[model samples]
Target: MRRRKLHNLQEEFINKFLETIENNEEYLEFINRHKPELLSNCDIAIREVKFFDVFNNTQLNNLIKGISNLNKEKYSIDLSLMSKKYKDLNYLIIQYDNSSTRSLCEVTFKDDLFINNVRAGFTQINNNQAVVEFSISFKEIMTHNLWIDFIKENKELLYGKKFFGYYNIGEMIKSAHFALIYNSISKVIDAALQAKLLSVFSLNFGNEYTLPQYNAIHVPQEHFKKEYFDNMFLCRTYEINNKYLIVDITSDEGLKMDLYFSGLYSSINFLQLLARYRMDLYYFLFEKIERFEINRRVNKYFLNSRKRIALKDYRWLINKIRSLNDNKLRENYTDSRELLEDWKSFYDGKEEEFIDFENGQYTKKYNTIYSECFDHIKMAYSIQKENLVIYIATLSLIASLIGIVTTVLLG
Candidate 1:
């Protein structure tokens, strides 16, 4: 069989992913609804950062201090350093990386628009995970038509494209404004990576062309028809595999755009959802790592032992498989056990969108990896148990033979 290239594998994965989503009856029905001509009057951008690990003690402290000083001196931004501890759905403190110490910064993008807050944080337990969150919002009150033009003009930025040419919002203004904010955020991240404060790994599909992000749009209540669900093209942009959650807010009583986007409770809920999604990505990556590790160990075991593999060596493999299962079953920062329940309460009976969002992201894929890992663990445990019984029976036979020899010699 000919070996396939990495790019080919990525292309295949992407194709299969799109096929699965596009073929879903619900998704198809939702997409087939009458496409809305209405556009958003305001837009919000949420970017998710997944850091594999963070530095320890001195190194971490220095990086935080350096970034804080740089933010004040160069970006004219104040930094707030705080510790946050989150409890799971049952109000129990999660055992894995439950607390995070983060530094927050706020920047004003323009007179009315703001890049509300940017956070860079690391977990307290082993510093195994970190999250960076930031959002951009346009505060100008514009007519729906003007907002449509605004989205059209700034599509490049909204879509998270790195570069583009000639937008109606004045090429210079578009470039300068976004570039300044992006660069400011990028500088902090770059510094962290350079200082070894955080580390990240690339997925098999390769580096994403654009940042992982979600968009929130405020549309008029009359325009928030079922057809708007099919507007995924504009919300997702050209990144098929990088589809993000698009939340459309209307002017209904509790669903008011202003309150949904700006209310304290709503903001916190949005942050929780974002955090959960980030953690989901983390689990997906961790599972891939574990799967690769298991395969590598299995291959190494066969190659190194050939035909003389010891029982102890087998025991090591069994222990490793058990460890993998233990890690998978351990409680994490996000409590997925009650994810649906929490999302239902938060969305106020609109949990379908959340479900779709998770499915679109990596929830289904994560479950697939999890099931694969579980199978491996199960097989390893079965083998271990069988070997243990055989070893015990062999020892019993040897003892009986020794006892019979002693009796024969005495006779």
Candidate 2:
């Protein structure tokens, strides 16, 4: 794409990384050795792979411990973990001492597949839900035709069709395929669950594709060329659907550094965005009382003390929704912010309509939910106060009668 650069910081960072690669003797030698194959055959270079999955936080502490143990046992290395903090004022309301931190573990593989480095992590979204992310870096070179074939095959695999093939890794005698890569991921998830780290209610796998800078100027297909690259910022071609995200950068900018960073950031952020949306929907539905059932439900909420317990849960839900909504699009960079907002709008179902569907409904529903909770809690308190008054009055009468009887007996 040939659009204006979104931000200078991104450009500078990408350029610096490219410069480092150029200056490194090992990288330069590898480039020179593969120059012929790279120039003549490779149309699209698959630089990285990222996968995200959501899980329920059944045993959050155990899950973290399990992840740490898994890394130590499997990779023989400690987890490279860090907490992602939001300094935005909006986040201050939601921040708590025990808030879940993002924990990460890096695993490197040799002679297995095109993938070399894999970093996996999890971020707890709410008290009950969490998301695990996998970022894989690849050094695979593929012809333009092979690239197209891979995309097609991958799409089928994503949609639940089984297919397998092997790709030669440079001059190595052994070859690796996508099946092995996917199998490894499945094993990790299975192990986590089997070991009772975390119980999962549902699981979804999402993918992000980062093409090398060389393909930015020369997109493989004419349609994609017209759709993505024509008069758009190289980074602006952040195409996302329910299935996958395609992130690219301009050739002149540098190597695929921007791709690596942005892809990871966007994939993780988008998953969070989607998770929050689903949570909002789920909470709304869980608490929603239909008009026909409103009277019965209200009575149940008021008279039945057990049903009133949901009021506390409702309060928690309100706080969670507010935190998630307020914390959207907190990124400082323009491209990242824009991409997240775009993805939010897409998942929020605001793309086609004139009205903001998700946010508008959110505001209205939130107000209704807040008001309902307030009224129910207030009524419950009032009933308790009335009962206390009656109890005190009855006790006073009993005491007076006892005093009168004692005085009569004394007289």
Candidate 3:
């Protein structure tokens, strides 16, 4: 649970960091100099081990520990040969490729065990010289996120094509199979299983389903049973970490909460990639908002002119305005008229009072969007005050107002 909480916190931190950098000029300049190529390549391909077989090995305990060690955790191996003294066993082996995508293998040879089944198949190794390694440990395999981090932090040295395998030492002598054949067969089975899981999960969230937002619905858990989705959704709220509370749509318990959350995480990751690449878009819009407000006040042409801007320009402006409607600005925007009044005061040569907001550096910085949107609408009102009769310009200004209203009402 703690690890999951930390994962959610890390995700939130990444999003806020993306937002902050995109909104700041000096910070962007720093990025262009230091890490400009970050989002240059976004066409990523994801593949995984899909199948494997259960084989007998004298060193199964050591092998599982080897898999666990790839994730930065130390493991002590315990091995037992079916001698007269001991007979209990629970062990696993994990095989992965150069990208560090993994497949799990479990072996339970105890006579008293309830479950016993083994499947295997073959897959080609892309790198001939790659060495096979494993992690054998007592630590739970639940923290897959941290394990990926361990591989990524050392990817340069770890690159190699590989797959998974489980060898049955007890059957090898009788079966007459080579070591390489055992490895190949096990990986094939593992790959098939992995593929099945991915297929089922992917289809569950395809285009037709729209996950519900918990914040929009009130589920009465007291009268409804767990079998009812509404009650389940409300009960599931307790399972969500605070860091994921505001943004996680899965808390509402739609058709498939697990897949919804997984897709949501992937979507956020893709957005971060966009944030890294189109950082200039953010800066451009932020500056545009400021300059537009300041120009409306200082330039007479902007105040009297009734020119309609392009639809694209209006859309960009609308998105920027909506961004300011987050939780941080909810209270500030309670009275829209008052909000606009304060913004007008800031624009009419009171720039110093609003410097903190203009720069997106105020303590109430989360309210930066609210402040920016308010200032923008107020500026538009001031611009059209004299010539409200010009239909195009009047409509343009009204369109901007409608953008904010639509975002608040529907978003």
Candidate 4:
């Protein structure tokens, strides 16, 4: 049997609906502007990407070998896309879909790593921050379970024991159809990435999702709802109105439709944007913790009572507290006008955590300083008053003695 090439299928698929889908000049222009730059350094521009550290020679070699060993005549998991490489990463764009429209289930999980591209945004985490431009009407659906089994076989040989929980292939069999893209990635990558490949998937799909009874982790059905996705504002979904450029998908509730897009090529950029602020929030937390630690240590020293705290020391402590004020940074990040309202909202929410940290820890520190300083000031005043009183008493006693002596002499 002559195997149909995925490129031919993609061309046919795009051409069939090309007239309706290609009408968006704005989106087309956007793609045109960025596509060249994104694809310039690579041989295969349409392949999926897998990232690896340059130092992980063992993992990288195994990945390349797996791709080399694939039987070209078999399933639609195209090996051609995996041929290209740039630096320590490989691009393996999937041109085939293995899941049906009615089959894909709605899932809700918080995955920080899936969209985390903060180091350099698009330039750095390109391996993990990918755009899966898929249309729901698959020209072919391969056995997703077969690909899953392929990943399980690589548990020891490719991924090793440290990444066992990460490769937890068991969790994926439930949504096997929709998740095949990730599962295929597990096997196709021989060894280039050092844990990040699995990390990307684990971070993407690990926490919240509903699988069929065959694969359920026992989440109650009543708890799941479409409203859950409303809170997932950070999640970017693009739909194809027409057949050519538009991507298609089915809702977990069994609704079938092409995903519509206002012309953002991918959510990778959005992920990067949020990642920047997420990094800021993380640093903010780190600083707050450090301030708390410093306050604790200083309060302990003040409690000792033997060490003298002077007026100047009180001023220094106040200055240190003032320095911990991240008000400006908070204001800058939580800008209402500059950023999207949802992003701004997220920033504000994270900033609240910072405020709570400051309020709780700093309040304790302030009270300790206030009590210690107040007692020191009061004790100093008392000492001066006691000296004055002693001097007056001595003078009075001398005067009495002088008076008595004079009287006796005169007599």
The TM-score, computed over Cα atoms with residue i paired to residue i, of candidate 1 is 0.36
Q: Write the per-residue lDDT of candidate 3 for residues 1-411, one digit (tens) a residue.
A: 354554454344333333333454544454456452322111111211111111223233333343333222221213222222233233322222111222333332233111122211111111111112111121222122332332233222211111111233324333533333322322232222333222212211111112111111112223222222222232222112111112222221221112112111211121221122122212221333334333543243234454533344445445444433322222232232332232211121122233122323432442454356446555665565555567777899899999999999997
- Please give the CA lDDT of all the candidate structures: 0.35, 0.37, 0.28, 0.30
Task: Please report the TM-score between candidate 3 and the true structure.
Answer: 0.16
Tens-digit lDDT track of model 4 for 1-411? 122343343333223222212343543454456564423211111112222121123333334444444344421232222333433444322211111111111111123212222111111111112211111111222133332343333323332222222222333333333234222342232221223333322221111111100000111234323333223333322211211111112222111111112222232222323223322222222333334434544554446643544446455455434322322233244332233322211121122223222223433454465556546545654665788799899999999999999999999
TM-score of 4: 0.23
Best by TM-score: 1
TM-score of each: 0.36, 0.36, 0.16, 0.23
Cα lDDT tens digits for candidate 1, 318-357: 5443423333433342354354444321233232334433
Task: Please estimate how well model 2 matches the true structure, expressed as its whole-model Cα lDDT.
Answer: 0.37
Model 1: which residue pairs collide?
A: none
Each prediction's RMSD over C-alphas, in Å, is 15.4, 18.2, 29.1, 24.2
Give residue 163's lDDT in candidate 3 (0 to 100): 15
| Tens-digit per-residue lDDT, 1-411, candidate 2 | 222232333334323323433354544565577675444223433444444444443333343344444433334434554222322111111322122335456665444333355665655444445556556554464334443333333322222111111222221212323233322322222222221111211222111111111111222332233233223344332323321232322321112212211122233342344333433322222222222223333445555745334554445445544544543442122322333454321222123322122343544565575567557766675676788799999999999999999999999
Please report, as a residue range, the 10-residue window in candidate 3 with the lowest summed lDDT. 122-131
lDDT of 1 at 122: 34
Task: Give candidate 1 regions above 4 Å deviation.
Answer: 1-66, 71-74, 82-103, 107-127, 137-209, 230-265, 268-278, 281-327, 330-339, 342-411
lDDT accuracy of residue 196 in candidate 1: 21
